[model samples]
Target: MGPAISLLPALAIAFSASQSSAQTPAPYSPAKSGFDFPIYTNHPPGNTLPNDPVRRGATTPPLHPDETRKLIQVPPGFEVRVFASEPMVVNPVAMTWDERGRLWVLELYEYPRGAKPGEKPRDRIKILEDTDADGVADKVTVFADGFNLATGLALGNGGVYLGAAPNLYFLQDTNAPAGSGAGALQKANKQTVLLTGFGLEDRHELLNGFAWGPDGWLYMTHGVFTRSKVRDAHDPDGFGVQMDAALARFHPRTKKFEVFADGTSNPWGVDWNERGDAFVSACVIQHLFHMAPGGQYNRQGGTWANPFGYVGDLPTKGLPAVVDWRHYRAAHAGICIYQGDQFPPEWRGLVMLGNIHQNALNCDRLTPLGSTYRAEKESTLLGPAGEALRAKTGATIKQGEEWRHVGPGNFLVSGDPWFRPVSVQTGPDGALWVMDWCDRYPC
Candidate 1:
């Protein structure tokens, strides 16, 4: 009588969320006079947070039905399902592929709702196309149309680098449709805001995540905007999330944005690990994907959590993001790392994530997802759309397998909270792709 903690399946728990509170609650919350303000860092610049960037703000893959991310365990080999759920094709937070394997995704139409913080978005920044890998997406165009809260997407140095929140753009494929084009996305167009005044949600700052670090440089993270309610100055909530949340490294040759690692509160997902070194994830759709390997980090060092009377020291903090704090809260979006081998290679470098709170998607190994950041591995069950909901629920566990487990990181664990596949990419074709901003709906 002591083995059944196995819950989740109450319809993937809260699934679609009733619809309309502007799509089921939480968005619109900006203007605390723009959340309060007090940022700007890099430390020695006279140590700052006195606010700057205006203060702010703000994925793909697809699959739904038959559950997702339930405390994962990946060891059996791999089969995971769903792969498609386009909730009308909009909120696709961040994804990239090009070079011909296709898969684009940036579509994040007006996503931050209620509870008041700095709300100001109407929509624009769509772009999707699956071209048959089946994770869903046959078309959902409009690559850039008045964006203000786009949040992460990269190809690197050569082009296609976006993150738009306070605006960061570059698209010249001019009208990329008819199969997502190539030759550098057939020369895209529009979208040109390289770096404007980021709104910084409330000192959670803004932008969230962005990556391109194979040494070519680009790494980023910004979130802590409640104007200046002061949430993360170094775990401002610690495992509770938000620690002054800010880490940067985008010297596209001195285009400058330095500020290498700060307190960071809303440090959402950013990646780099084939050795070029660099990994971050604190989007908090639930939390535990907080790795920090820009090389054992050190803005001067700081990590003594409980001394009460250190009088003045605090820089012993080198690689501390193992926050695996229990059952994620929607963990809003991602947690990618795995280097790839199509699975079962000892699961390779290991780390594949997307637990939009549940519906499932995780597969750890990055030293045990940073050492028991929960999901030591597995939570597959995502794909073939379960033969379109098993013809309508006759559910005999239909079809065969290839990567299936479906839910268990305590049900779509995100580290702590948030929902929907916020973003996931460990691609080069070794396989590990998720971005389901709505995969087309019904997850």
Candidate 2:
């Protein structure tokens, strides 16, 4: 095990192998093989890397968790901690809370580079429990494994829901071995394939953003790269419906699946408010949206056709986004509406979002505007009556400028690249838990 692997507890053995264990070796190039022939090196058009560092030299190594914690800067009253990292978990993309308050995480170990032909699936689903109430995960369990780029996770239906790109599986832990270590890795007692063909045109664009909607349906998101033909088992025709770039939901008991909102590039996060209104943080264009049933939003480079293929006014009827940041400088990872009470009353109801590229945490509030809703561009913490609350982070309306993400103020910014914040979840204790993807690559 390397330095990164040392962070894992002995029981967390799935990722104990070296990072290079299953990686493919780079191909041998004749140019670098002492063949000094006349090289035609001219500038290429469009997207091309000017300085390709292929075999030039090695880059910096992974940062130590302690070192990373130093570079993080949270809002004054808030503190950030490396709940878990490295060998214990790597590439922790998205996570969900189980009925028992256990955190189930989706580990896409094979990301940036999807599984190659003939390669075995190494991705896994891990359940982290802080039994000691130390605000840190003390027990790590391998709930499941053997997946290829598994990106989404949810807990319900008497088991765990896994997003394996084209297929969705419900696995119950009834048959799980009682102990940890190698004995814990057993097939689920009951396995149900709820749906299939969710599409994997691109690895990252697979079926994701799994959330149990306030309306009781299982909601998920798929990017434009995924051209899906999804169908439930109960469908008599045995033919799945075509779906792409939309917010969709499924009913386990009814055996029904439907698309609610359309025209999203790649929505990574989805959360529901007290009134059951849904909010999402998407990738690429349309960074923030207020989704409604049958609503349509436009995606650049899309056919401009309705995601549901509706006729009449549906094609031209697209809903505007709550917040269109105008720049693609940061890759937004996850967004969560603060439903926790541990934080100040003012922090409740504000939307907390994470920007992986920018290494920042964004906060904002949404207000109803006629038929649609609009976001408060300047992030703030409001009191019970929705008045600005003053705190060390300058929450006062006059000095609240420090909490703002837009305008002359800055959001919760971090100085280190390893501070990538991919998943943000409010814990049962009402504290915010962020998942970090600390590798050098964005994916």
Candidate 3:
């Protein structure tokens, strides 16, 4: 009877095959799928959905420097000129001004994929200056080089604090002769790792958004997906704090590291309002959040790190987002509360955020709401003319099958589709300084 052959092997084979078939997803095809695929290159002129609001049409080819400037449309009495571009400063990711008013720009040349082991780092920090004060950067000096995926920079504590994943470094200019002040032009020959264990699982979600808090701590934003077990560089084997999707701070003098606030998806921007309330701009999930120390706010997804649960609650829900309304996409970066005098008086106290997917700068008015502030959509500060004008007129634009309200507009609008603004800061000259990634692929 064939030893009364057990049917176990046959049953197991059939079950495994069935499970595989169910688990494997089908390859994406535009013709077979209902989802709208992004068009990277410009479609033919006769295409019907040339500028489909949701899908977002193809990016225009790279425009000349002058032509790109011409495409930018600022409000009356304001002008958009080329501050520095290309050969002078390429792929500037983050910037911080020094005591001398020079712009220290972090050039992330090795983005998307950072430097591999044994490979020389391509990222660098350059100091751009308006020598003639003509509202243009005339001289560029290399401050430091040989950094891997450097995302943030801040000058303080007699040196520069740089956020390059897996390590936060303090760089000093050893070449500076006697008593050179902060931001002096000296070769950064001394490097010290203050803290380590920042995650690099995602290049864009590294330790970034460096800013000095009013409380004297060096603030930084650590994004979602990547888990961090930060420990002092001095204690490599000691117990470390585990965190992700959090606002972290470090004290250079004490060499202490702390996870200030928790929860958010890829928060790329952090800033404080006039009242010293901390606000953060995240991507994918909610656009803005008011973060407090030891606070566990809502994250895009995932369970909280506290196994015991927050505040003794079994199912801990996080705090709410400051912004009430939703934009077409929630990908926002670089938050700035307009404290500059270059814009009109009404612009004061308005929260300016970089709407990456929409290729514009969005403004929001903040009102005190208990401990946190409520953010209301103010206007599309910068975008395409047709879209901005339509928004101002309270019209609706066709998005897929539904027509959505165009919202409002007030500031600059660049007709160029490749005009991607990643970071916005009020310059020392009181003018708004925007860092344009200027690329077709935002990710």
* Cα-based TM-score, every candidate: 0.28, 0.76, 0.80
- Tens digit per residue, CA lDDT, model 2, 385-438: 113123334553544323223321133555555355666667665766666655
Q: Which window of 10 residues has the lowest lDDT sum in candidate 1?
A: 1-10
Root-mean-square deviation of every model: 20.8, 9.6, 17.0
Reference-based TM-score, model 1: 0.28
Off by over 4 Å in 3: 1-57, 177-179, 308-316, 379-410
State each model's CA lDDT, in order: 0.43, 0.61, 0.68
Clashes of each: 160, 1, 0
lDDT of 1 by residue, 247-333 (tens): 655555555444455543455676655654455555432244344432222222333222232334334343444543433333434
Instruction: Choose the strongest candidate by TM-score.
Output: 3
- Please give the lDDT score at residue 414 for candidate 3: 55
Pull out the clashing pairs in model 2. 346-382
Q: Candidate 2 — worst ten consecutive residues by lDDT sum?
A: 2-11
Clashing pairs in 3: none
Candidate 3 local lDDT, residue 104: 81
- Residues 3-115, candidate 3: write the lDDT tens digits: 00000000000000011111333331111111222333346766755454434533444555555554554443455555565566667678878888887888776775766
